[model samples]
Target: MFIRTENFSQYVRAYPIVTFLLALNIGIFILTWIPGIGNQLLLFGIGDNFLIANGEYWRLVTPMFLHGGLTHLLFNMFSLFIFGPELEKIAGKARFITIYMLAGLFGDVATYFLQSGDYRHLGASGAIFGVFGAFGALVYYTKHVFPQLKQVILPIIVISVVMTFVGTNINVTAHIAGLITGFLIGLSYFNPKNIVSWRKKR
Candidate 1:
């Protein structure tokens, strides 16, 4: 179910939400590389608890689109690329974006309240983790009907948790918060019948 066989145009047509997200992320990252304004954008867009506390609340939203470096961007976008389509297809565009934004916002809010005043973060990892969390919720709700699906997501979850700890300079709070938020949102947002209909399409 995760393997993407679609070509460029095909993939875009099939998963417009994921396509738009990918484009927006990559585009923003590119804009961040443009010398002068790049650093300025980073300073302005990064999530700084100090700035946030001072009422620069947009930090919560902008960090979802900012990344520290190429590896950071690639990793988060790769995760989104891999795990996003299924959820987008199942949740539909509106619901999918809602879960993604809420999960990301929740993570950023957690970071603002949990971390130090000086702590700063800029990346889409929280949102990507939310995608994983949504998958978990889907499996949890549909397990009896789709027991075999667990085999697909369980390993990914394990690897993600392990990587979160093993990696350096990670925003542990955001990851955990995003995961919880996504799962909770999924619990309330997903309809079993919708999932069934989505599965039938597959």
Candidate 2:
């Protein structure tokens, strides 16, 4: 249901990394529709215990790129489309990627520990939550820069957290882990020293 407007080009110029990430996710989703390939891709997704314990550690990274269904893919991609450019502009490409991957890895790790062995999870919700955390951290350090961000992001965060517990299939552990991981990473990236230096330059 999401549609790009004229401003989409501006967003692309401002955040090519985010655009590339979106393209990559969409491309993978298209590939997943190819009958047997979908099954192969799902195998790479995060399974709670037995898969990781058996040494398929790569699942930690791969699940972020796989979606459970079309609706899942669209929802996550829409979120990325909405949030990714702004965060990329703030964090820059390298740091943003680091936050995303680390958040996702930590999310998978948490899910591994918290869920029973039989529980399986997939989708980019964990990493998306990390993006939310990064936005919160940035707003925290640069409160004067974007006073309205706190108002906007807080409700989304609360709703997301609440939704996790509302459904049986939702992986609240991964979401929490991703949020905490991103918050910590954001603290490191947007710490007082950096904030002070930025303020001085401004």
Using all chains and alpha carbons, the TM-scores for the candidates as numbered come to 0.97, 0.87
Instruction: For candidate 1, give the lDDT.
Output: 0.90
lDDT of each: 0.90, 0.79
Off by over 4 Å in 2: 1-9, 46-48, 191-202
Cα lDDT of model 2 by residue, 53-140, tens digit = 8888887778888887898899889988988766665676898888888888889888888888876888788898898888778777
Model 2: lowest-lDDT 10 consecutive positions:
1-10
Each prediction's RMSD to truth? 0.9, 3.5
* TM-score top scorer: 1
**Candidate 2, pairs of clashing residues:** none
Off by over 4 Å in 1: none
